[model samples]
Target: MPLPNTSIAHALDLADARHWTRQPPKRPATRLRHLLRQTTPSALALRLFAYPHTLTRWAEGDLDGLTPAQATLIEREIYRTWQPEVRRRAHQQILDHGGCVTAQLHARFAYTTRSGEFHDPRLLNVIEDLPALHARHLFDARHRDAADDELRRILADGIGEAYFFCALPPDQQQAALTISDLHLIHFHY
Candidate 1:
């Protein structure tokens, strides 16, 4: 009930209350005072002033006036912390489209995870490994070197559209859904 003494915890509580309860205190320090007023002063003091240690930094003016870069850094940190969630969303996207199909591979290749953490289907133990699912493509060891060569060429050429697709083997290219399929509209002609 009492807001945690930590800044991260306090921010999270504020964000949750703002988003879910639609009740955010008008002033930044109001929650601190409200918590202290409701809870035992000694308990509040112990938690707020003693254990976390950052309170002293705030009191000493060390944590004031955060720069935009600092705020961005914190946001990025929080985003990075949600890698599991990102992976879950990506994995779901893959599964919902028909597992391991050529269309699914194309969709996945074009996908971008917001958190920027790499999700190896194999690492997540998804139903199929990238290579296995694309077996018709790169699983053939004979073509691995050629595939790697193609991938390097595509990357070196600096083509944005081909970045992900270029990484695949010939078989994968053959199996992939065309860009037209990916952007198809259901409008009546």
Candidate 2:
């Protein structure tokens, strides 16, 4: 696959250094700092280190502010870490789209929880978005013997969909299955 026509310099030019500098440090920023220190050239790494908050902001999805070279280096590092088949496909997609593919992949798989930890995308539809009312009903009936004080707590802690389904009465289980099917379709679609 052919690389995108967009030059590294141009991509770097798209970043807004000022905006990144003003943001506070967060997990993404911290992770990006770590990646830079571990993978980037020492001088470039030092330059980014001087603006820790800004680096964090960039890691959190702010493309602006990074130099073209810096962006290229980061992208390369990310690509290098992927499994061979995944890397090949991602490279093809990036070439086909004429830009970065990691961002799209990251967005697809990344689901932030209420507590700020990344949630599994597979569990997102059934658990994360299960309505509080429905969850409460499930807990009251299906999970009656369980010690948890609240349905929300159980869901947040990561209950399996199969367990929840099996606990439901036959009719409710069917209903739950239907609801889950619809949710899965919607999520994948």
Candidate 3:
């Protein structure tokens, strides 16, 4: 889909007419930031019906910020229009303390599994395949140097090597250990 051609006044008028009570036009940047925060590049692609590259450029610090009016429209029409169950599951993924607890509960409440017979209502629902989402992220990182650099930067600055190491899969963990050892021997000797 083509990007919506919307002026600030037009978007404000749309919001006002649609009964959005927030006085957003006066503080436009805040509204834009809020929408940007809600959406990831992939999520934005899904919402905007745009290619991932368009959103990727924005995410990679290549594009300028979105207009407040455009942001407001996206938040209202795309993000808010997301199904409630999807939203709740996403919330639970972040808010739930332990994955084990949520996994068990989800298995009990929303799914049944047997040998070659796993059943899940959420499978038919949007936002259910978190495992697949996670796997896609892993695949992306493995294939993309930019993603690897981003992951390394995140580990170095935010999460620390230990946390990042712990988060890696067993095979990757072994590889990381070998690389660390090589670096240590090269520098420390």
The residue ranges of model 3 lying beyond 4 angstroms of the native Cα positions read 1-18, 25-32, 56-189
Cα lDDT tens digits, model 1, 1-189, are: 432222322222222232232332333234333443445545544634332234333334455654444333333323222233333444344445654311111111223333343322321111222322232232122123233344322221222223344566665443222121111111000
- Candidates 1 and 2 compared: the better one by lDDT is 2
Span of ten consecutive residues with least summed lDDT in model 3: 180-189
State candidate 1's TM-score. Answer: 0.24
- Please write out the lDDT profile of model 2 over residues 1-189, one tens digit for every residue: 534422222221222121132332234445465565555444435644436565656766785777756655554433333233443343344335543211000111232323453433353333233333433343243223233233223332223333334455555433212111112111100
What lDDT does each candidate get?
0.31, 0.35, 0.33
Model 1, runs deviating above 4 Å: 1-62, 83-86, 89-96, 99-189
Instruction: Compute the lDDT for candidate 1.
Output: 0.31
lDDT of 3 by residue, 90-127 (tens): 43453244331011001111111122322233311111
Q: How many backbone clashes does candidate 3 have?
A: 0
Candidate 3 lDDT (Cα, 0 to 1): 0.33
Q: Order of all candidates by TM-score, from best down to worst?
A: 1, 3, 2
TM-score winner between candidates 2 and 3: 3
Candidate 2: which pairs clash?
15-64, 15-65, 16-64, 16-65, 17-65, 29-56
- TM-scores for all candidates? 0.24, 0.21, 0.21
